[model samples]
Target: MSVAIVGVAECDLGQTGKSVLELQTQAVTRALADAGIPLSEVDGLATNGISRFSATQLADYLGIRPAWSDSTFAGGAVFEMYVARAAQAIEAGQCGTVVISYASNQRTARSRKMTGVFEEGTPEADFEEPYRPLYPISYYAMVAQRYLHTYGLGRADLAEVAVAARAKAQLNPAAWTYGKGPLTVDEVLEAPMISSPLGKLDCCLVTDGGGAIVLTSQSRGVEVLGYGESLTHTGMATAPDLLRTGAVDSGRRAFARAGLTPDEIDVVQLYDSFTISVPLGMEALGFAGAGEGLYADKPHNTGGGGLACCHPGQLGVLLLVEAVRQLRGSGGERQVPNARTALVHGTGGIFSSHATVILGVS
Candidate 1:
């Protein structure tokens, strides 16, 4: 049996002010429609959050009677993990169709602050919290600073990442930043500084949205060739090296499992929580050498990614949706020409957790 992503959809992006459940249900409905299936056919469900009963809660709200369910919380990489779990469930006869969904109202319901949320007794609280990094931008800024210093790169290198994403967004009508016009590297460099070496343009947009995917054992759609995940550290303070994220190990495992290589990927959808993350991920994923990972000339993040598309907390699900679109030749104006293979990567926490999924036409 082979697992295939049969359906993929994303809810409206940016400032919807909808409840998390509303966003999730809308995405689920859209996904089911795309798959030409009904809720009754879905026997497995997966999501992520701090809530202990989220799986049951979602299953009940969606009126699903899932025989298998998972609520695995791994920050942004949760949805990729869900895809892996859904495949296992389908292969083992535990389920036939599995739906993986994600939703967050972070922009509308909460402050953008990324501090003091971790458990009080955890390493984040003991070491990272004391530093008062304030928001994710600040933490990522520290990493950006280190990366630039170590590699002899400058802020201009990072600016290109933002510029490329914005350029891609211009072609994506659904992107949150669509119609904002393309951004130039100089403009990105001049954008207000959020933190040292990182300006507002380098950061991702905060939005409220949801996305879902339906997977089946029969290979009737884009096949999930391989998947991999890794966790290096939970806190920025505890990370072995800020410049080296877990994407290296995860990407290696995914490519090996898929029997592919960096050069074989036709499109790349690396998580871009910050402009700096793009280069970091590229290097880790073997797309480029150290200090040379800025993909100004490569085909990547064609839907603009989190930077210009939408970032509603966990973005792995959206990345998967975009990859599916590209693989199916339905990416519209932003579609990569004859895209046959895609590498979708997601990062969680500061640089802690990582997940990679390789998808190809069936």
Candidate 2:
């Protein structure tokens, strides 16, 4: 009944000009190879960003008939949720080996645009879509504004997060902003504004990339020690508290299930869709006190994260890839010292969806 991540990998990062299916194939095959398991042995598949029938389409393209498949779409949090589901299926004897993956050509195809998180005839459409505000960003920006105002913090306080992420990316050769030189607080503050306090530098990299992770109950690698997920709302219009999110609930459940606490985790890989996401995630996960995570230095986002690293639409799957590498002690120059356990948190859809996964050596 124990589930473990046997292998994890990412395909061509940056602008690959490849289709989503092509990127998905590359990531999946490479991950399978890493696990020393052939594609024929993969009877489970979980993926999205391909088509409406995400899992079904990828299964046919890979020429495999999976006994179990999942295509849950909740933005970046989907992959972590998929890991939870895949582990359950393996434990239930529904599938033996599961391959969870995701890929996006948002940068190459220039399709990373947002009107709203709602469809026609929905409450969001009637109430929030008429103003023509850029969603996701605008929603997060509103939260950022509220958070800063609530705590009497300034924009300079958030700039530290971007500077720190860029520094970490410098240590990771695979990061998009690696070797781009060191970033300064002033530079981040001076960057062109995207949505109020969040400037261009405060955002994540837009790139073409994909990643995958292979899981099994054989216990050959990092174990899925704990997991949790939550959906507070679909759109920001109905969101109750702009500063508080479901990450608190998800992270608490994960820690309680893992029999561990934030202090025990040696490494962290929270989805950094924007600079604000990091501090907010830290506070939500109890790594720091209320309104204090922004300045708290912790072992987090060693591979630059979505800010300096390649962000292919959804960054959840890649978070697992980075965490696995760190846990395996294969982090090279960016390897954390005496690292044993790692925590990964992903947020999606303007902080509407959340997932937290705790990983440790099997």
Candidate 3:
């Protein structure tokens, strides 16, 4: 059976004052409108694991309770997994219309709090967070360091990905990182250092926003040609391999399911919480050699990714939105002509979990 994304919507990114539920509601309404559907018709609802909002609250606000509701949290990649699950739900006749939503107030509400750490049972009380590691920035920085050490790559190579993403963001009106013409390698290199090898420009901004997409299996939406998932950590990062992730395994599976290779992908939406991730994803997705994925010619993260967009927990949703828009030839200034196939990579948990989805125009 084939699945398609019929509608996509997102609230004003980077805008504050909107509650998580309100943002989610707006995105839902927009997505339904985009899908040419109605709230009463929505029977399925899937949300990210890390989202603070509740599905019941969303349903109450929308005045339509879904028969199938999933509130699983697997970090940012959960949205990609949600899409894949929506396909099965559509095929099983469990629901003809599914809405996947996520929202967060990272910038204003987060307030430098250690929220992610507290969410997990804090060993802080007993062990003083002995097993606890650094925030995403520091953790991913370690990976970047290891990557640089293992591959002999310098900061300049990583800066290229940031420059490309920022350029793409300039075309994306919804992107928070949107700005003037492309950034130079020197500019990125000179940016303030946030976490050692990872500079300020290399880090994604903190953002608060919500985004949603509607899916149907009737081939009336963007085709869901393939989906694959993999995991590198079990809740915490006790593993030794920090630089490399499960993206390779999942990406290969996704491509095989679509019966296509990396070369066939017209655009790539690589999860770029850190500049290092772009190059890492390139290798995992088979775009270039291991530790050598950062190059000027590749069409990776053309829309600035999380680094540019900074949609808090809604990063994965934005990636899906961009991919769908590109595949439908509706990306306007950022549009890639003849973009028939697209790959969106969603990652979460310090790159511990990953999901890859291949979309095609049918």
Q: Estimate every model's Cα lDDT from 0 to 1.
A: 0.87, 0.90, 0.80
Q: Which candidate's TM-score is highest?
A: 2
lDDT of 2: 0.90
Off by over 4 Å in 2: 113-116
Total clashing residue pairs per candidate? 0, 0, 3
Stretches > 4 Å off in candidate 1? 113-117
Q: Candidate 2, residues 154-207: lDDT per residue as tens digits?
A: 999998999998999999888888899999999999999999988998888899
When 1 and 3 are scored with lDDT, the better candidate is 1
Model 3 spans with C-alpha error above 4 angstroms: 49-53, 110-133, 180-182, 234-237
> Would you list the rank order by TM-score, best first?
2, 1, 3
How much is 249 displaced in model 3, in angstroms?
1.3
Give the better candidate number (2 or 3) by TM-score. 2
Alpha carbon RMSD to native, model 3: 2.6
Q: What TM-score does candidate 3 get on C-alpha atoms? A: 0.92
- TM-scores, each model vs. reference: 0.96, 0.97, 0.92
Q: For model 2, which pairs clash?
A: none
